[model samples]
Target: MEWLDWFNDSIAYVEEQLTNEIVLEEAARRAKCSTYHYQRMFSYIAGVTLGEYIRRRKMSLAGVDLQQGQKVIEVAAKYGYESPTAFNRVFKTVHGITPQEAKKDGAKLTSYPMLTFAITVKGVHAVEYQLIEKEAFYVTGLGLALGKDMEENQQKIPEFWNEVAAAGRVQELLPIMDGNSPGVLGINLMTKEVQEKWEYVIGVASKEVPIGFKQYKIPAAKWAVFSGEGPMPYSIQDLAKQVFTEWLPTSGFEYAELPDMEVYLDNNPTDAKFQIWLPVRLKRA
Candidate 1:
């Protein structure tokens, strides 16, 4: 099956076995992709991490059962929780109430329904892109260790950028170049692990001249570049997500095992434009 079909199949499996213990690794195995890639794709497309979705779905069902006069322990057991206490802890964390309280007061709670996939055909928006084949370029910027939770990383990235700026290292480390493209840049580095660690750089691209800054050489490769005009960081990130979820699977291209780079065209956060370069190789039919 194609990669997009594999992703849809994985989502179907998750929906079918909502009440079962859905291990991420097992889900990735079924999809024939690494856990890191699976989780990243899930979050990019679904707008929520897999673990968060599961917890919300479980809690939503538990809330319904509680309202239906089912015992808390019974609902807990049905959802694969070993004990009511465990269920209660998770429920409180997600819904901000215990099972008993939710049952007695009919408190408001969050729900995460099963996801359904559909393709919508629309008029093409002009996407400014180029297939660039360039020699290796050295990139240097801030590097930090990311935790296992992808959601945590998403929330922390903006702050990380601010911290980099506050330290005044961005000025010294990543100097703006005199070119048509000049602005903040982000470089993501990944490894082969289920909970992969990534380093994000919120700096500008430079051809040369820098010390006390980490350097990474991006090898010569085919790149699909997409540009967007909007607010900084968020717009860049949205484009990245769309590339992984919408472009790669449908474009008949397989992603290369190399770091992706985002170059900020204009660095001002309020009025920013950026471009993303995704490394890919055409799949052999």
Candidate 2:
């Protein structure tokens, strides 16, 4: 429950900082995890990116402020929008009406409250997983830098995969497979603060950093590897949410500040198999 306390503390911090410039490192410090995994796990468990959450929260408050007679430009500037136009665009998207409408009496508005982390089980049994220590190795592949905008990254990832497939990049990478890690890897180079952009590489474990491919190192650590069968991404994504929200809180381990992997075993249209590797360490008593 200490981790849960810490995770909730992180949320409180995010809520408090919404009116100021949010520093993700501070939130991760409270959560006791890497900025990357803290934000990554947040997206997985909450089914929305941390950025999107923040945006919703800002808009929700903006609606209230507008209803209380704050001018639209003032509300926009308060929420860090550079211009009233940008703020008004997002405001309508969130509240399903313009800021002017939000100020009208008896107008409907949506409120997104601050989130807290808690142990929740969907009546599902313990997720089957294996804890194994892996030696340091390397993966070589094409890399795309992922910025802090989680919603944009969500769309970008599928587009990246589609582009890779359309270009036969997977076939191009198969011959370079040299390490013992299975399948083509969707490796996250999440070794930086959230403010600092990270990379997501679609490649295989190989000793060689071949030309036209970027190479990244996977550090040695114990990983909680979850196996799943069926579909390309949804199956593994669901498993990951279960892992972070259901299993890890009781597993006596903490999410390590390291990169994780998504190993795709097969890419069949109806039956894809995959593994989600999460780096972990024993929780400090």
Candidate 3:
């Protein structure tokens, strides 16, 4: 309940600050979380970026202002837009009409109401996971920079792995996996500078990388490792959704700000078991 309370309060704070310049750090502070973790969690649960959500809410309010006979320039400035053209472009994107049209009688303007966080109890699936601690380790292999489009990245990632396997890169890199973690891993490294993209590494745990291979060291930390069975991708993807929506809010843990990991147990992912490891720390008392 405290988790939901904090998150709802954070959303309320964002709504209150919509007319002013919103500082994400302040929003995170109100929620008692790091900006990165806050943004990541918000995107997963709310299905939009924080900036995008704010933009929509602002435009929604602008539509109301226009309907109430407010001038275009005044409404634009009130919502933090520099010029009427810039405001009209975004306003149309949301409401599908210009600000001038919004002022006319019986104009149907879109609305994005204030949001509140809550948990719904219904048909729940069993989630399998364990809390494990590990020492610092390294993964050595090839890496790719993936854009922020999660749907696109999902398709591109499997293709990258397939290419690696087809070219015998797996066998070439398997020898280097003589470290603590078992099997090869798909690592997602979130770049702080670029929130819209992340670095994906297909590698194995190793202390020393082979020549012409990239290596990344994972810091020692506590992890909540989740397991999924059945078919490739679908099962894992379903489990990931459950982790964020069902398990995480009630797990009493916060993200540890480290690269998340996925461990592959079998060479073939078609119908094998795999694990998703999330770096986390127990919530403070």
Candidate 4:
């Protein structure tokens, strides 16, 4: 099956068994992909990590049960927790209150409803994009492996950039920060499964990078580019979520196994612009 079809099928499976035990590996198996690839593709296409979606769904159901006056322990058991204490801990982490407290005090709780995919058309807006072919470029900067959770990644990425700046590595790497290079590039390395952990580099593009710095060769490929201009990371992240969640599935393309890149356009964080590159191969119509 096609990747998009596989993804839609996986979503249907998740919905069908929302109240049953679901494992990441099992979902990947159903999708006929590796767990890492499945997780990464799901996050890329869903705009949220699979784990986060599951947690939110569970919490939302818990809230519903709490509102219905069901006993906290019974609700917790229905969601697969062995003890109310464990459920309460996770519940409070997501909803900020124990089930009993939520039931007794009528506390306000956040609900993450299951997402429905839809396409909408109103006014037309022009999107600027180009498919360009270029030789491989080397990037040098601070690199780290991120965990499998999107929330954890969102929190750590900014800190990683800050640390690279505070340590003056950006200055040290100035030679590579030429105008053509634009801003620092954030590259996601493609390994096995999408969920499988991979290294991220916060660095600048260079034709000839220094020996000590880790270097990655981005091979010549076609890129679907999107531009974002506004606040620093927020704009960049928002564009990414839109592209993956709203654009990819509908576009006449599917993800190819290649490095995804982000190019910062301006120096100032509050008023910076960036470009997001997604590797693609044309889908057979």
Candidate 5:
């Protein structure tokens, strides 16, 4: 699709300006879309912000420059870092070694290549979804800040769930679930400006908020609901990934700015089944 080409070309724009002062809006110019939507779409498709991608690409090349006898300060300045201290901190975080050590004999470094989006045959396993209209609803639960890094969220979310369950948070919220509402809801709520930054909340659907509970009102919208089976978290998580990586590009629907709802049906490990309600609307609707 032409959209895929424009998005790839935006990546090319970022790569070309890696060593210079990068204008983020220039990426939008290359893609022929607003800067906001381009970055928002990028976060959904790539699972990282455009800025984070640029940072990793710059650090990857900076590793090569350091190993080729460039001074740390020079490499830092070349990549738009203000100080060696800040550069060293980020370099070590990405590469697992100081920039000075990278110049030594046989130093190992991490390299994050530029990303590209494409549609490949994603295999025979079918991904199924349906469109439904839903009224506005509220969920009451505790939440944790979900940042842009997919890896970080993968680690944090399960720990958050564990903490919630161990503290009997689910039981406390269960007393109020409406008959129309599913049991405990695991919701991935994102901000309009940055889709990747989220607050993952586990709560119940209720109009009545308890004294110590937080309530989030999910606005009425058309939804694309998908079914998942097999296991907790992993199965649903994999389904969500497929929905984005495979279904979304070809689905002719863009996500509405709303929270995604995960409804767990039962506690059985072997026969687990759940539903994920993803807010969506027709591309031109």
Candidate 6:
């Protein structure tokens, strides 16, 4: 099946299980993808976290149930809320009113329509990328543990970079970059799954570990190196999203189980040409 079709089928399964205790793993299984990848892709493409999507969907349904004269407690129980109070709070947050208000005459109830995945032709421009293979290499520099919370991670990362700059360490690390891949890298290594801690490294490719710097080895593998030219973050993010949503589904390659690297071409943070290196391998026939 096409990736988009499989994704929509998984979403349909989610909708069917909304009233029951939904198993995210089962949903991902239906999509023939890992739960981690599925959640990440869903958040990127849907513009909402998987948890948020499920919550909003449940609240939307609760509003409908209340409007149909179902008891608030019954609706809450059906949606797996422990109590009507908890349900009301969530319902109000999503629909802008309490469940009781939703049942009132002419009360506007919010509806979260079932979500389906479809590929739209992004015809304006094509992404520029190249496939390359390399031997094992090392990246060495300062690293920090970033928490699972996406919003907090986004805010904290820039501040982390600023702190590194303030310490004047970039100059210290650059001269020692003797590896084949020539550039400082912003690497995110997924260390844990349940709590989802990302170990972020600001490092350059190197052969040996430099003093006072941590080193991570980049394993030998085939990589899809996607380049984008623009200002910080926005351009890189757009390019990455295109890669996951548009390219990966149809590329006949699967994400390799390796740490991805972001290569910053210049020191200018505002306008830099950067490349996102995604490790990939051809799918089995």
What tens digits encode model 1's per-residue C-alpha lDDT throughout 1-285? 366567778877877777887777677877666665677778887888887887888788888889888999889998989887889999999888889988876478767677765565532643456787766766656676776566777778778877887888876753445354365567666545211566665545556646666665657779888878787657777777777766777777776656677776655888777788887788767
Candidate 4: stretches off by over 4 Å:
1-6, 16-21, 25-49, 63-83, 93-97, 102-113, 177-182, 193-197, 207-212
Q: lDDT by residue for model 5 over 1-285, one digit each (tens)? A: 777898899999889999897776688778765454466567767887777788789999999999889999999999999889999998898899999999999899999988988867774778878899989888888888876444566579889988998998788887888888776788777645324556888889998788878988778889998988886657876787788667876789876656777888776666688888878877753
Whichever of 1 and 6 has more lDDT, that candidate is 6
Cα distance off (Å), candidate 5, residue 46: 5.0
Best by TM-score: 2
The better candidate by lDDT, 2 or 5, is 2
Candidate-wise lDDT, in order: 0.72, 0.83, 0.81, 0.73, 0.80, 0.80
Ranking according to lDDT, highest score first = 2, 3, 6, 5, 4, 1
Q: Mind giving the per-residue lDDT tens digits that candidate 2 earns over 23-100?
A: 988988898877777887788777788888999999999999999999999999898998998998999899899999
Clashing pairs in 5: none
Q: State the lDDT at 3 in candidate 6.
A: 73
The collision pairs in model 4 are 36-193, 36-194, 36-195, 37-193, 37-194, 40-194, 40-195
Sliding window of 10 residues with minimal summed lDDT for model 2: 188-197
Encode model 3's per-residue lDDT on 199-221: one tens digit a residue.
88988888777787887877788
Number of clashes found in candidate 2? 0
Worst 10 residues of 3 by lDDT: 189-198
Q: After superposition, how far is residue 118 of candidate 4 from its true place, in Å?
A: 2.4
How many clashes does the backbone of model 6 have? 0
List candidate 1 segments past 4 Å from native: 13-21, 64-97, 104-111, 175-183, 193-197, 202-211
Q: Residue 217's C-alpha lDDT in candidate 2?
A: 75
